[model samples]
Target: MAANFSNSLVRWIDHRLPVFSYLRHAAYDYPTPKNLNYWWNFGSLAGISLAIMIVSGIALAMNYTPHVNHAFDSVERIMRDVNYGWLIRYIHMNGASFFFIVVYIHIFRGVYFGSYKSPRELLWILGVIILLLMMATAFMGYVLPWGQMSFWGATVITNLFSAVPLIGESLVTWLWGGFSIDNPTLNRFFVLHYLFPFIIVSIVLLHIVALHRFGSNNPLGIDIKYPNDTIPFHPYYTIKDAYGLGVFLILFAGVVFFAPNFFGEPDNYIPSNPLSTPLHIVPEWYFLPFYAILRSIPDKLGGVISMFGSIVVLLLLPWLDRSPVRSGHFRGVFKIFFGILLIDIVALGYLGGKPSRGMYVIFSRLATAYYFAYFLVILPVLSKFDSSRLLPKSISTPMPEVNGIE
Candidate 1:
């Protein structure tokens, strides 16, 4: 049969390089929780999205001119002149958004299921590092377009460093590579933008290694108790992941082909002008919540610190949440607070996109407070006082049908 033939070939290749054995062990025979659901698919989805970005990026780079003088025109040229360059460019542009979409879902699933606790803390930390790296890479990539928003965005974000007591101005100057965001800034961003994706790949590999070491956290949040509680990664989870990938790709393609500019700013189409500024400057949607937090504070230095602290708080999440139970499904109060936190974040994101004045500013401040309070106060307090429902004795226990699927 084909299976036997493939196994024989794998054995032969394994004798030479061991690549087949490693693949077989890692991808085929690896034990995965039998209870894993669609939420588990986002990790693989993120990986696929990264691959799409890297490939599309390389194609776009082949036609991209990094100089500020020609960068905008060069992008236009790619759209009009290069063979299928429009498709390549659109995929790269939207892939960045899709990548974040997948990663955010992955991270939320982790939090909802308490994937960060205990032995998986390091795994969660690695994912946070990957998120930071992806943000840096995406920011630099944005600046490479040499458009009004790209140039001004770089200037504004870099200027945040000037909030430092004595070194602020000097740090911004150093980052600009001159007096302002000119050719040097564009060139450096181009180089780093290309380089960072590979660095992300390296970190992703480390993330996988760490994940495999700890195994995956299932929705049940309980350790596997019997052989029936786990299944081989090959036929079971692989098929589930493949189905998820198909659905993701259909959505991704719809955006890339039909609404490529949905996530892009209209101001970014204009060439960079030192004298003119857009009426409203906003980053990509993924960064809006943090941006709202940054602008909520009146003090420049305090705003910058608080903005960064928003993300840094996630690094301590494993310890911040001291609950013995993992899944929010079993914890009624924590689940409600988690839903509120999600709404607060969406509000922050909306406020971030709006002008920082009047009621928006007030809401931003309130939402920012809740954002921090959720992690700092709510979670820790809930850990001590909130009662959780009894959990299934084992992951293998069959449950009543819910959501029409079970």
Candidate 2:
């Protein structure tokens, strides 16, 4: 029979390579916490977005000329002449924003559920590394367009390295591949932009391996003591993820078709002009909060340190928050502070998008202070003294209503 032959063929190959068995264990037979909610969907969504980015980027690169003189013209040609090039470019262009959106949600979910604690510290660290790499890759890709904003954005950002004490200017020169941003700079960025995604894919595999070691953290933030606390990842979560993907694609298609330039700066449509500088230069929306933090401090070196410190604090969160309990559901005070932290970040982002003048600078400094204080001071103090409700026994255990968190 056809089915029997297929099974025999699979067995014959799987015995030699074990690739099918590995996939079955990783995707189908893996145990995941049953209490995971819609928030968990973002992890899979992020992976899907990365795939979209990689495939579309490769196609775009086929038509893209990475030299500064030809880059902008080539992009225009792709839009005007190449068959379906506009669609591919739009998908890739808008996909970056959507990718950040998904990853941001996934990160906040991890923070809320205390997924970074204990055995998962390395997992959290790896996630942060991925974020850093994404930032680098996105920055490089932004320059490849060779537009007005892209040119000035690169100039200003690369100049930030000059804030370093001794080797600053030399480092900047090395980065630029000459005295300034030119053809060489663009060529190098093109190569790195093409390369970082595959590196990300490798880290993602390690992330998955680390994830399966500890299983998944649930909304309850409790360990799976009973076997019934978990379910096979395949049929249940796979179907759930597919549904999420459906909804995400609808939104993505709407953006690509109706408002592909929704996230783009108008200045970027013009070719790069080294002599002319735009009135206001801003990085992409995702980088705004860090930009605000960077500009908030008075000294250049201090600002750079603070900007990087914002992420470093997150990397140290597992050791920083000494709380006995995990999820914010059991810690009312921590939950309130977490909400305030989110608002502070939003305020910082808004401030970052605006000119660094008037009340914007003042508010940004305040928000930046709170951003560090929440992680450094608030979390440590709360961990020691906050009266958290008792935790449930396991992921499947019925949580008692202390103040109605259930």
- For 225-255, candidate 1 gives per-residue lDDT tens digits of 8888888898888889999999999999999
Judge candidate 1 at residue 32 and give its lDDT: 88
Q: All predictions: root-mean-square deviation over Cα?
A: 3.2, 2.5
Candidate 2 per-residue lDDT over residues 1-406, each given as its tens digit: 1222258889787877787888788775688899899999999999999999999999999999998889999999999999999999999999999999999999999998899988899999999999999999999999999999999999989999999999999999999999999999999999999999999999998998899898888887878898898898988999999999999999999999999999999999999999999999999999999999999999999999999999999999999988877788788888899999999989998999999988999999999999999999999999997444477777777767754554
Clashing pairs in 2: none
| lDDT values, one for every candidate | 0.89, 0.91
Report the number of backbone clashes for model 2: 0
RMSD of 2: 2.5
What lDDT score is found at residue 389 in candidate 1?
Answer: 38
